[model samples]
Target: MTTIKQDTDIPRTLQGLDDDRSSVRLRAALAAGTTPDARFVDKLIERSAIEPEFFVRDMLTWALTRHPVSLTLPALLRELRSQGAQARSQALHTLSKIGDRQAWPSITRALLSDGDDDVARSAWRAAVILVPEGEEAGLAAVLATQLGRGERETQLSLSRALVELGDAVMPALRAASTASDRRVRAHALATERLLHDPDAGFEFAIEEAKRVVALGGSGQEG
Candidate 1:
């Protein structure tokens, strides 16, 4: 395991995060979070936007969470508007982990429907986490627009996010189940199944929904 020795100088620590080795960058991120320095916030957020390693990016988010929201929130909110998809995704992810409602308004519909699947997925997760009280249904409506948007993983992510909203998503799911798009209706039906049967696997539900769609039948039929 690579380790970065404890250091007082922030620049050296920030530089460590950019090391060529993933292990070194991981250690640097861990060190930043372990120490919780405000000066490291910008570096951490910048690194998070472009970090190639998932574990390292996750650590950077952890590091950002350790800092004061007063500093991290504004930076994260700005990152949400960035052209880089990873930046917006990571910032949304960190904000979700921070659980700041003030950042809720920044979770825009454009982000929810972002062209990038990863960004849209992260936006869905973050929106579910940050949505204000009484807004779950509205958020679900927006999310429902992407029912058949991506592949299995993306569909599952959307399903989980909607399921996390509990009954609030029922209205949106119901509306989507009636969509003219077979994929959208199938996804909505499969999601509804998972919503009712928590033990049901998404793959099984989705496949069954597909079969139903192929047969020109509503997924409501057993």
Candidate 2:
């Protein structure tokens, strides 16, 4: 049985990257993507665009998945704005894993429907997680736009994120209940109502308490 080598071998193991064996080079590139070492990251970014084979490029993108969120997210965001489909898709996939506010500009900008369904879907999913925890206007805008496009997954994911953000999203959540899309409206309402039911979701309950305190807790007195 052939054992998979550890990432310790990493970039060095893929010595065949420029060799005749495509699989060898590709696997090596993917392995190199794991290290948080600064120099290795630069090498991955360099290879992301120039790698000859499509699958090798995919492996290089996969490497970015394990990179530090702070380092990898910024690089991936930059990649998202590029015109190449592979560059955008791979970067989107990695950012979805890290999901931070720093990801907002790129992911939110690409949230609209234009060309690819999967890429659009991935963008919405990442946006739902990465947007600021309390940016109601921004959250509503992204959700409303995607909801208008009739993507139920987008609506559901956004509603779930709003729920995760606590009652700060209540105003927007309430507004979303009136969305033009019935599915969006229903999902938003369900999320809003969950606040009153502790058993509905533990995370929602914790977030609700945090939101209440953040709002000065005056309402809970009544």
* Highest-scoring model, TM-score: 1
lDDT of each: 0.91, 0.58
Per-residue lDDT tens digits for candidate 2, residues 9-69, read 5446445455567788686675576444554665676566556687886777677666777
Q: Put down candidate 1 lDDT per residue, 1-222, tens digits, no spaces.
A: 123344444677788999999998998898888888778999999999999999999999999998999999999999999999999999989988999999998999999999999999999999998999999999999999999988999999999999999999998998888789999999999999999997999999999889888888776555
Per-model RMSD to reference: 3.4, 9.6
**Global fold similarity of model 1 (TM-score):** 0.94
Lowest-scoring 10 consecutive residues by lDDT in candidate 1? 1-10
